[model samples]
Target chain A: MISVLRRELLAFFTSAAGYVLMAVFPVAMGLLALFVFPAVLERGASWFHTKELTMRSFFLAFPWVAAAVMPAIAMRSWAEEYRGNTFQLLLTLPAPSWRLVAGKYLASVAVLCLMLLTTGVFPVMIAANGGWEGGPIFGGYLGCLLLGSGYLAIGMFASSLTSNQLGAYMAALLACGTLTALGSFAGLAGSSGALSSMVRFMAAGDHFNLLAAGYLKLETVTFFISMAAFFLMLTALGVEGRRYR
Target chain B: MLNVEAISRSYGRFLALNGLSFSIGKGAILGFVGPNGAGKTTAMSIITGLLAADSGAVHLGDDEVHATPSLVKSRIGFLPETPPLYTAMEVSEYLRFCGEARGMDRQQLGERLENVLANTGLSARRNMPISTLSRGYRQRAGLAQALLHDPDLLVLDEPTSGLDPAQILDMHELLRGLAAQGKIVIFSTHILSEVEAIASHILIINHGRCLAFGERSALLGADGKERGLTDLFISLVKKRNP
Candidate 1:
């Protein structure tokens, strides 16, 4: 598993893909925070009457960006192997299917983390302006990581279903979009308060909303972790199921 | 020894293997020959435990491969028809990945990597990315990967498909040497002369059925006359399904 992880990392870094991804991720975030949204970017001194910088807007924009970028990041995970016919070589190796899935997932997550880390200077730049609330800033970054992980897991599951990279990318985007949309926006349709509440509880964005607000809650953390694990398990089982069919 | 019994696989409506069976002992080079869609790759996939048979079993010693696939897989090395190369990876880098994936310890890999590269005629191209390699060199890289594991059974599908004449001859010598060292080598090829020159046993398959499975002499005519694999294949592969 470690070897697979190492190879996956090497594969990303040795190619143009990694450098492009790393640069794009933070560059997009920086653009969104500093330039894209005039309402937030030009919200005169002290960020809409508070001393804190406009990081809330960045956290809000990050998930949407992640939803799009993560699919591209993970689209090649299994899809490339399937396309190149290397699944035969990979599946026959003396390792469990879960190990391969986990290795790839971890490598991709690490790439996202590398991107996230580069954006750390964003908060630092914001802090340089004074009045930095550490809790909300920490929570904002945490929420983005959790949300990115959830999206990436879904992306890997999407990749497992097809050999075409574009198909994998679309499948992942469609799945993540629909699931997150349904979970987050289902309340708009339902007249019943209980049903709406249940949907809100189920929605990934709802939990991220809480975390980004600096409300540290166990349920939200567990929800994000389980979402990531569930999709990863799906990918592993998918790989293993190939042998039977 | 390797044994495949009653192995059958059907993909949707197409039956790829139909009760196919064959066996070979160690220190033998088994040549697998058939036309394009004759279940050769399917059989190889089954034997390597990469694909499951709908009905039937493969055994290495007393362990049924379906039951203990992980254990059996450790002792087998496979090179599929497409030459599973990582396009982004250099030849040496890919071989290192293969060796480590097979659980070759650092020292063992160090000891064997050079030899495997040398034997596959890939020493000169070790640093080149597989995507940049010529067809013949890519095939050699694939062969290099299979040999890296140093398995008890080596299953290769069309191992000499893209090689030039000299490279094909080098492959023949490599297989012979491996067999002499007691590794069971099973390879499929379209070249009849390649099989005639190297394989000690021939397993002729057609339409997912085993037409002939025997030593070189056992596949000879009733008068015990000498014949090439091409003639035997032509005579044995019945045109109409029986």
Candidate 2:
């Protein structure tokens, strides 16, 4: 497992894709947070609350950002291995499929952590702004990672389904996009009715917001963990399936 | 020592391997010669415990590989036809990863790293990305990865498939040296001269069946038969399928 992680890290960093992703993700976020979001929000009276310099805007925006970035991080995980014919070598190793998947998953999470680190400036700017309390800031960071993990898991699973990186990326984007879109529709379903409640319960945004609120509910944590585990298991099965055929 | 008994596998309606069986002691090279789709790769995959046979048993000395694959896999090094080289990784880094994947401790890896690199003549190119290496070097790097953990059995599928004559000769010498160290080496190849050069024993297979299995002398048939390998293979395969 450690070997897989080390190799994954080495592979990611050495390639042009990893650098481009690491560089592009933050820069795009900076442009949005620093310029576009602030500008657009200020122009719309209905978006007044969104224009406020609070952590909610940043937290709210991340799921959308991660919808793109996480897939980029994970698209090549298994897809490239299959295309290169290295999957046979990997499967033949003494370690089981789960461990390999776990290692690769963790490696992506490590990069996500690094990408998160680059966003530290946002929290610091929030801190420097004085009016906002610290509670939602911590929660927002937690939500971002938890939400990113779910995206990573889905992307990893998607990668395992095909040998084409573009196909994997599209699959992940579709899955994550649906999850993101569902959250907004649930929000529109309006806060009180059972129909609204059920959609809210299923949507990732509700859990992400719960974490971002700083309450740290048991169910919220369980949802993210379950999402990660479910897809990781699927990824393992996808890998193991190769030997049978 | 290795024993492959009654291994069979099917792919939908196609039977990839049909009750194929062979065995070899240590310090021997088993050359599997066959036509395309003859199940040579399937047999090697089963022997290495990478793919389970629908019905069969594999023994590495005393332990049954089917029942305890992890142990058996640790003892075996398999290089598939494409070599499984990660183009993004440098030779040394990739070799280290293979060593670790085989469960080699840090100290064990350190001790063997230098030798494995040198054995495959990849020491100088250790720092270069595998993509930058020539096809010959890439193949050597693949061989280097397999040799890292120092497994008892080395299974290679078409190890010399794409090599030029010089590269092929280099591979023959490498296989001979590993066999000299008493590693059970089994390689599948289409080239009869490769089998003629390195393998002391040969198994000629076709349509997922073993047409013949014996030492080089025995494969040449009884006293004074002295047929060339091409002639021998043609006659045996023709006689069996016809």
Candidate 3:
């Protein structure tokens, strides 16, 4: 299992996919936070207000970006093996199925972390410019990590469902979109009370929003962890089902 | 040693193996000869625990193959019809990953990798990416991965399929060497000439059933009624059809 993990990690670092994700993701977020949101970027903005805007901007853009990028990292996880018939060789190994799944999952999560770390530039810029609250920035980074993990799990599950890479990408995008849309203004306006609460709880964006605001609710943490576990377990089950069928 | 009893598997409406049963003693090469879609690959997949059978059981010595598949799998090596190469990886790195996955320790893995690379004639190409290799080298790399752990049972699906004549001869000599080393090597192929050149025992399968199972000489016949293995195979398949 350790060897498998090391191999995956090595491959991620060596491949262009890893470098592109690590380099592009935070820079994109940085550009959006510093330049695109005029409401947040204009002069006379206090440090607290600027940091708050940065956090909001990151939270707002994370879902759409992750929904697009995480799938590219995960879609080839098992689908490429099926395409080249390497899956047979993998299954024949003495290691249990869960080991392979977990190894790949951890490697992808590490790459996501590399992507998330790029956003450190934003906090550095704020600190250099003026006084800002470190608490919210810390909480916001944590929220992004958890959110990215959840999306990756979903993408891994989708990838396991098909040998076609495009199908995996599309399935992951659709699933992530549904989760994001449920938290939007359009989603809340159409529902009320308990239905609204249920929708919010199920939406990843809703939990991320709370975390971005510096609220560490147990329910939100549990929701993200449970969501990640659920999708990873499904990915394992999907791969197992292929052997019998 | 291996034992299979009444193993049947289906893919929805298609019956791939119907109550198929066979057993081989330790260190014996059993050639599985069949026409296209004769369930040869399916049977090997179940035996290697890569696939599951709908009914029946597979046994590796005293252990049930399906119930305790990991234990059975640790002792076996498999090469599927298509060589399962990760084209992005270098040959040496791929073999190391395969060796460790089969439960080899670092020292043992290093020694084994060296041996397999030497035996499979893959030493010169060890640093090259799999995608850059020729068809013959890719096939050799596939065989090397299967042989990395010095497995007790080698299940090869068309080990020499898609090779040129020279490569085929090399594969024949390689299998012979493996069998001579007291390793049980089972392979499936449609080429009778390959079988005649290398196999000591043969199992002729047609339409998911074992049509003939015995020594090559007995199946080919004697007493001035000598016929080539291809003629014998064709006759057995024809007899089953009629």
Candidate 4:
């Protein structure tokens, strides 16, 4: 598994894909935080429009941003293996299926962390302004990591389903979009019924919303962890499924 | 010894490998020949544990491949038709990755890496990225990875496809050397003469059924005269198709 992780990281760095991805992720997120979201929400002249110095606007745009970028990060994970005929080599190696899945998943998450790390300027800016609290800021960054992990896991599973990278990206985008959109459904978050609560629990964005708001609930953390694990298992099963069929 | 026992696989309504069974002992080189889409790749995939046989199992000695894949896989090395090269990585880096992924210790991997690079005649191109390699070198890189682990069994599909005659001869010599070292070699090729040159045993299949499998001399010289594989192959295939 460590070898796989190292190779994956090396593959990313050695290819044009990694540098292009790094530039695109932060730039896309920066654009949204600096221009798109602030303008759409009519906050102020910029993200700093209000007197409050928080990353609230940034976290707010995270699910959408992650939905777009994490898939791009993961679209090539398995699709390239299938297209290049490398999966035949990989699957035949002595490692177990879970190890390969985890290795690839963690590599994407590592890339995600680096991508998120580049946005350190946002938090530093929030702190440099002298009115920022560490709690919500920390929670929001944690939320972004967790939410991005979930998005990437699903994206990897989508990639395993097809040899076409574009098709993988679109499938992942649609899946993540639906899960993120579920949070905005009428009365879903506000309702108290068991069915609505269940639906609310299924919305990945709702869990991210809690962490981004500095709630730090255990259930929310579990939701994100389980979401990542569940999709990772699905990706493993999809890869194994090819062996028999 | 490797034993593929009554293995069968199907894709929806079409049968791919239908109760295929074959075995080879240590130091034997078995040539696998069939027409295109004749389940050569599928059978190779099943033998390597990359694909599962629906109703049968491949055994390496006492352990079943499907039952203990991690254990069985460590003893088998497979090279598919395309070579499975990661074009972005250097030749040495890719081989190291393959070695480590197979769970070789650091010292063993380092030693084996040098040996395989030298053996495949890829020492000069060790630093070159696979994407920059010619078709023959890429195939050599693929064979290098399979040999990296020093497995007891080596299964290659179309091991010399797209190579020039000189490279093909080089590949035959490499396979002969591995077999001399007591490794079981099973390779598929479209070239009947290549099989006649290197294989001690030969298995011919058509439509996923074994038509003939025996020692090369016995199968070819059965009637007190040497018979060409091309004539035998054409007659056998025509019998099945017609």
Candidate 5:
């Protein structure tokens, strides 16, 4: 497992796709948080009343950003191997299939962590502004992590569906998009009561919203964990299907 | 060293392999020759445990290939036609990963990497990224990775398919050298000359079945009784189709 992880890390760093993703994603977020959001805040947007408000905005915006960026990083995880014909080589190895999938998934999470770390300036700015609530800030960060995990799982499932990286990227975008859109007033969850609850349960926003509000509900955490596990199992089953079918 | 019994594989309505069975003795160099869509790759894939057989069993030594894939896979090395390689990684890095994937420890991996680099004549390009290497070098790197764990059996699918004549000869010689070192080498090729150059045993497959399997000399028939290997291959294919 360590060997696969090491190799995946090397590949992620060496390829141009990896470098572009690592460089572009964080810079884009930094520009958004430091410049764009502040401009919006300065435009008499009084709803963002306190440091908690600013953190909530940041947390709320993160899922959309990740919807695009995570796919760029994770879509190639397995698809590239299939395109390059390396999947056969990988499968023939003595290691189990789960190890390979897990290793690649972790490598992608590491890259996402690096991207999140780059946005550390936002938290610092919030702290500098004073009146920041420690609970919500910590909760918001936790929410982001969980959201990232769920996105990574969806991206992995997309990767397993096809050998084409572009196809994987598009599929991940669509799937994550639907999940993200479900949280909005215009989306299915907002207009319907029962669907709102179900969508709230299914969408990353439901858990993230609680975390952003400084309420870490056990049910919400369980929701994200279950979703992540479900997609990961699907990815594994997709991989296993290749050998059997 | 390797045994396949009544192995069959299918994809939807298409049959890839139909009750194929064969075995290779220790240290033997067997050439799997067939035209396109002849189940050569499907058979090799099943043997190496990359693809599962629908209804059959493969035994590497005493272990069942599918039932105990890790055990069988640990003792086998395989290179597909496209030479599965991570082009982003350096030659040495990829080889080290391949070694570890085969259950090698750090010390064993380091030693084996050095040995395979020398064996595949890739010592000079060890640190070069695979994407930067020439086609011939890429194939050599693929061969090096497969042989890195020093497996008892090697399954190569069209290893020299796209190489120039000079590189093809080099690859042939490399397989011969591995066989001489007591490794069971089974390579697939459409080129009859390549088979004649290195293989002691020949298995001619058509459609999805093995049409003939025996010593190269015997399969070619008695002197003047049959034509060259290519002619034999053509006639066998025709006979099967007819």
Candidate 6:
């Protein structure tokens, strides 16, 4: 597993894709947080004009940003192996299937962590502006990591389903986007019913919202972990299916 | 000894390997030859435990590869035609990954790494990225990774498919050297001359069934008959088609 992780990390860092993604992710998050989300939620007021020194704009815009960036980070995980003919080599290795899945998943998560870390400038800027409490900032970063893990897992599972990276990216984008979109519809389902509650629980945004609000519920943590584990297991099964075929 | 028994596999309506069976002992080079899509790669995959046989078993000595794939895979080395290589990695880095993936200890991996690099004539290029190497060197690096664990059975699917004459000769010599080291080497190719040059055992197949299997000498000329592999192969294809 460590071997797979090391090789994957080496491959990622050496390729232009890593640098491009690192550069693009923060720019995209910045545009969406300061420009796009504020335009949508505040009727043309930018985050700076909100009169608050909080990272609420950034936290709120993260799920949408993650829906794109996480899939980009993970789209090549298994698809490239298949295209390069290395999937057969991986299958023939003595390591268990789950280890390979975990290795690839962890490598993507490591990159995600770095991408998130780059966004630390958001909080630092907010701090240097006037100063705000650290609790929500910390919770928001934690929520971003957890939410990104779910997106990465979904992307990895999508990658295992196809050899074409573009197809994997599209599938993951659709899946992650749908799950994120669910959060926007929870209020329209009439606010106080089993259906609305079910939608809220199933959507990743609700849990992330709690963490971003400085409320660390155990169920919120469990939801993200379960989401990651579920998709990772599915990725392993996809790999194992090739052997039986 | 490597023993394959009644192995069969199918893909949708196409039966890829139909009750194929053959075996060879240590120090033997088994040349697997057949027409395109004759289940050569499929059979090799099954033998190495990379793919499952629908209704058969492959046993390397006492362990059934199908039942205990992880255990058996550690003792088998496989190189497919394209060579599953991470082109960004250096040759040594890739070999180290293969060794560690097979659960080799650091000390053992260190020793094997030196030997594999030397055996594959890749010692000088150990630090070079795989993407920068020529095709011949890439194939050598692939072989080096497969040999990193000192596996008992080495299964190569068309290892010399696209090599130049000089590279082909080098590959033949390498296979001979591995066979001399008491390892079982099974390689697939369409070149009959290559089989003639190195193999001690031969298995010929077409349309997912074995056409012939035996010692190269006995199969080439027996029952007071003598023929080259080409003549035998042509006659066999003719007999099957006509």
Per-residue accuracy of model 5 over B79-176 as CA lDDT, tens digit each: 88889988878899888778877778899888888888987789999999899998888988888888888889999988996678877878878888
- Model 6 lDDT on a 0 to 1 scale: 0.90
Candidate 5 chain A lowest-lDDT run of ten = A44-53
**Native-to-model Cα distance after best TM-score fit, residue A177 in candidate 5, in Å:** 1.8
Question: Candidate 1 has which clashing residue pairs, if any?
Answer: none
Task: Rate residue B221 of model 3 by lDDT.
Answer: 78
lDDT of each: 0.85, 0.86, 0.83, 0.89, 0.83, 0.90
Error of 1 at A135 (Å): 1.7
What range of 10 consecutive residues in model 1 chain B has the weakest lDDT sum? B220-229
List, residue by residue over A1-245, the lDDT tens digit for candidate 2.
88899889988988887888878877778766666655565663332345466766567678888888899899999999999999888977988889999999999999999999987887777678764667788778888889999999999999999999999999999899888778778868888999898777778877887778777888988888899999999999989887787
Ten consecutive residues with minimal summed lDDT in candidate 5 chain B?
A: B219-228
DockQ of 3: 0.83
Global Cα RMSD, each model = 2.3, 2.5, 2.5, 1.7, 2.6, 1.7
Tens-place lDDT per residue, model 1, A13-105, is: 987878987888788887776556445545643234443465876776776788888898899999999988889889888888998998899
State residue B60's C-alpha deviation in candidate 2, in Å: 1.4
Q: Per model, how many backbone clashes are there?
A: 0, 0, 0, 0, 0, 0
Q: TM-score of chain A for each candidate?
A: 0.90, 0.90, 0.88, 0.94, 0.87, 0.95
Off by over 4 Å in 5: A34-54, A185-196, B222-227
Error of 6 at A154 (Å): 0.1
| Candidate that would win on DockQ | 4
Writing each residue's lDDT as its tens digit, candidate 2 over B1-242 gives: 78889999999999999998888899999999988889998899888877878998999999998788787888888888888998877788888888888888889998899998888788899999998998888888988888888989999988887778887888899899889999999999888987888898999888899888989878876447787788988987888768
- Evaluated on CA atoms against the true complex, candidate 4 attains a DockQ of 0.88
Fraction of the true interface contacts (Cα pairs closer than 8 Å across chains) found in each model: 0.76, 0.85, 0.89, 0.89, 0.91, 0.91
Candidate 4 per-residue lDDT over residues A14-118, each given as its tens digit: 878789888777777888887677877874457656556777778889999888888988999999999999998898898888899999999989999999998
Between prediction 5 and prediction 6, which has the larger TM-score? Answer: 6
Report the Cα lDDT for residue A183, model 2.
72
Candidate 3 wrongly placed segments (more than 4 Å): A37-54, A185-194, B222-224
Writing each residue's lDDT as its tens digit, candidate 3 over A68-145 gives 888888888888878879899878888778888898899888888878777777777667766456666777778888
When 5 and 6 are scored with lDDT, the better candidate is 6
**Residues forming the 10-long window of minimal summed lDDT in candidate 3 chain A:** A45-54
